[model samples]
Target: MSLFGDDELPPVTARESQLDFWNQVAFERVQAQFKSGSMHHALLLLGPGGIGRETFAQELAQWVLCQNHSQLDSACGSCKSCQLFVAETHPDYHLLAVEDEKTQISVNQVRVLIESMQESAHQSGWKLANISDVAALNQNSYNALLKTLEEPQPQTLLILQAEQLQQVPATIRSRSQLVALSVNEQATIEAWLAERKGGMTEELKLALSLFPQAPYKAEDFANNGDAVKCGDFILDISCLMQGNESPLALAEKWLPDIEDCCLWMLLMMRDLLLLQQANDKSCISLQGQTEALTNIVNILNNQRLMQLNEKIVELRSLLIKKSPVNLSSSWQALLIYCSQLAQKTAKSA
Candidate 1:
């Protein structure tokens, strides 16, 4: 199981091959900064989840703390510090993240890190910290971190991994130098999945479109096999949105997994937008739902369709927070939204 109790993310060693390119790029950048004497106190790495930002951060931390660092570039991997890092017991390094029982990174955790950071490194060299998913910091936690970032310790390297850069404060963003790691191109992701012998689904594609920043989460959903069925259900739901037929009749029969249904709603909204904006069916993943796509296109305008997608995102986030989510009500609201959109479009035409 992963940190969130989700049985996603292949074991650490399995992820190495997929992360080579990203790690090389990040390592080079860090080396360049070190050579130029322009290394910042905090480095924010913005990227999609599971495409290796966290892994790269770990490798970079190793490079920074390696005792046999003869070059400004790479870690010797055989050095004492590198050995400790590989063993996950490096005294000067820390990883701050929302572990079990912690919904968000709290001020107390930040305080503990700050106090530890104030001391000299165990090896009397660089202090490397990886704050995985910095966006998990609440307002209070963010404020708590401000003083630490503003007056960082000497020879300390802070690597922050965040899927949502917007959630972080402007002040914090400005204080850190950013290295943006983008969503792995389809080829990259497909290749990674291929290596893992993991199967993909249309739901995975839909999830990619809906949650671009967290492709592995989508991959996990796809691997479940149940989510693939939910994809079919969403296509049916899209068809039902075309007429006066009540989706409520089928909702109880088909909504086996509430999370999957909500995810389907999110993807359907995305498909609605894709149909509205893009003419080339070959360019996007529509899962051969062209008839349903046509119906949605005839109904939704760009803005309202976008708003519908936003609502789905809101619902997904609520579910992630373990909040009590009402999927049936959300689905009913979506049906109403689509029906109104179709009616308005027909009237205008």
Candidate 2:
């Protein structure tokens, strides 16, 4: 699963940088809890994907485990605990998540973490376990976790991060305090990107438009050529709308990365919806494709656009859930729907 891929965990330094702008508020909340000595044993950090929820959780875990964290709630970099954390070998810290290519975190994984909680803290400080994707916890895993959450471990902090709170079991959510994170202002994000990368490119701008809530991901997409692929996908779909491309051919071409293609199509459908409603264009994801989107809006009415939007959303949801799907068939079906909508529009015209 892409959500739990074998990507290396960002080092403490990288995580610190990732949390630069969005951390202060969430950090302050955790700090206050720490100061009052009433910190919740389990904290659920809720936010959109790519908005650094996991990084925030890691930062909070470090703050709790740091032996010499000052009153300002900052981790003292020179402390032994801080060093161990930076080295990603903090004996008192544990990270639990679905392994690479796994659809869910297994019961065995949860049991191991739970058993680890039974041991004493290695450094006589807080023992922190950060669960990166709480939503990916299977039923058995969740039950195992629920048991631990119900029976609190003193000085043990469990940080749960998920994009959607509704996916988490109600019993577990009720036990854990919730902290929501969101994107910073556009200007703030752009300024940060400029400072970090020396300048912003068109790819970065489109990435920001696509993932406004996640500056880090936007930057990554821009740097790693994913942003360019997204652009090409948009252009290809625009060609499809013009009847110049075969949906089956396009679907076959994008079979390897159909999830991303679906995501791009969803965003394009969103832009078309906005344009049909005469909403502000600033909210559109495909910044330079306004002419193509406007042409699409001209071809489709609001109702048709809405129907297409629903179809695209359903497809995206299925892809995200890792459901068994025939990608080519699905894409062809969507294209057929679009073709039918266009025909209906022409008849009405």
Candidate 3:
């Protein structure tokens, strides 16, 4: 089930970052597809953010271009073709992604990829093109890419990485061999992380509760020690929510995990909803998170909580817009709004 190579193919011992169980499952499925001669010309990998679909897709490409394409389940990592793949010099293999943060994968990139596929492969076998973050494509780019899918090159494989599958056009979806990537279960992810020698600190647990399926992301926090900063930020957040300090002033000092802070707030909001729904206090899922959510929930009633959650959602939408707002100011505004609302809740309660 190792995504990097086949079961018979030797395991990749040189890997630094680890792939989770679900990623291995995806690898196994891709291997099966190749072995059965049922591999589609186009594959669409859909999944939640932070799931290892990009890594899975890259490994799947290597498998497809293996020189000794015998069993079909895996790539012979030692083969000449595989070497080229590893070196990223494989003439037949192409990857297209956003050119930069400001620009998307333009129609020109798609055009070049499609044109390259029309030519013969360096290994004279299969051709692979991985277009990552397919949803990042503009309307013109998607339409341009659609033509290539309708008339795919022989012995060619196209992989699309879709984080927001809903945003992709239906035409692209219908043509692709749809593969859904899911987060590994909590136990599975924890075991995977433990094997990778992660410290498994409380911050990691907190991130897992928020991100849930992406252990690598949890490991990221583990490596950087951002959890401690988050802990401090949460304390300041609690103070701001309680009107003991200015929200804007607190935002200036709490900068390590700005994104994590947003995610924590969202997760805490969900926990508050759970608290509201539960008949018994012990039924709350936020057991370890009690200290974090207590002040967050105390500041807002159910309706105010809903509105605050909506603001978080709106912030995410604004982030996706071509023009992003000043993130720090945005964060400060959110904190101030929540703090003011918290005061109202205290008065009402």
Candidate 4:
């Protein structure tokens, strides 16, 4: 499960292949800064989730603490500091993240981390702390961290990762230097995925499109049999709209992946809306299922699609917020609405 206990978001990959391939450019930029003595104390890595920012941060930490080589721009795994880091017992490196069964990092966690950071590193003099999701820090937690952000601890590096910058404060943003990471080379990612055994080229490419800028996530989707699951879901949605599948059964069947189901519904509705609005297939996201999506476009009007979209959005918000909700029943109503809308349109035709 992902940090949020949802499979919709992919966990950060520790694969050396991905950490090196996807983030080499970003890594080199920071390395250059380090070599030139211009590296900032606080580095904020901004990117979409699953693009290897956290892995880059971890590897960079090891590289910084490695005693054997500073010229290689990477950790020499045989070095003492590198060994300690690999074992996750390095005294200088700290990882701050949301606690289990909790949504956000607490102020107390921040205080404890900050207190430890004040002390000299027991092994390497360099102090490194990585906040996995800086956006998950609440206002109080941010306030608790402000002193550390404003002050300077010699050789201290704070690696902060955030998917949403709007949730971060202006003060924090000003104090940290932002590093952006993105990938537009679809062919390169596809080529990489093709090299993996048990991965079909066609399905891999389809997953690639679904997770834009997140190639590793696409690979995870394929490896976890999510592509097949998603295919079944698409078929189920088509069957529902065509008045074949019952909404209750489909909803119950998909209850375990409720959040993902909501997301897929939203994306499907988004595709349908775009198809109706622009009359262009390129405007839709589910490119592999153009025929089914086109038929969906005909099954519902813009107003109905928008209505269904609003409900999906609301339910997804509730799920992400961890609010109490009757997901199975709610999803059944959503599917039933789609079927009723299709039946009404068919009768009119």
> CA lDDT, every prediction?
0.69, 0.78, 0.74, 0.79
Model 1 lDDT, residue 70, Cα: 41
Q: Tens-digit lDDT track for model 1 on 1-349?
A: 5677445522222112234563566667766887677989899887766556877787677767776454535566665567687788989999999979767888888888888888898973889778997778777878888888999888988888876666567988999998877654666766665456455556666556655545566566557774557556756666665664565655565555666667666666666666667765655455656676776666667876777677768766765544456866765665566566666776776
Q: How many backbone clashes does candidate 4 have?
A: 0
Q: Which ten residues in a row have the lowest lDDT in candidate 4?
A: 9-18
On residues 189-291, what C-alpha lDDT tens digit does candidate 4 reach at each position? 7777778745556567657767767777877876788767776787788888888889888888998988767767776777788899999998666767788
Per-prediction TM-score, please?
0.73, 0.84, 0.80, 0.78
Off by over 4 Å in 4: 1-18, 100-103, 166-171, 198-200, 239-255, 270-291, 302-349
Order by lDDT, highest first: 4, 2, 3, 1
Q: Tens digits of per-residue lDDT for model 2 on 195-278?
A: 788898888887887788878888888889897787787777767766778777877787788777777787788788887676
Each model's RMSD to truth, in Å? 8.6, 7.7, 6.0, 9.2
Among the numbered candidates, top TM-score falls to: 2
* Ranking of models by TM-score: 2, 3, 4, 1
For model 3, residues 262-288, the per-residue Cα lDDT tens digits are 766676677787776663446443455
Q: Which residue segments of model 3 deviate by more than 4 Å?
A: 1-20, 48-50, 100-103, 198-200, 247-258, 275-292, 317-333, 346-349
Candidate 2: 10-residue stretch with minimal lDDT: 8-17
Give each model's clash number.
0, 0, 1, 0
Top candidate (lDDT): 4
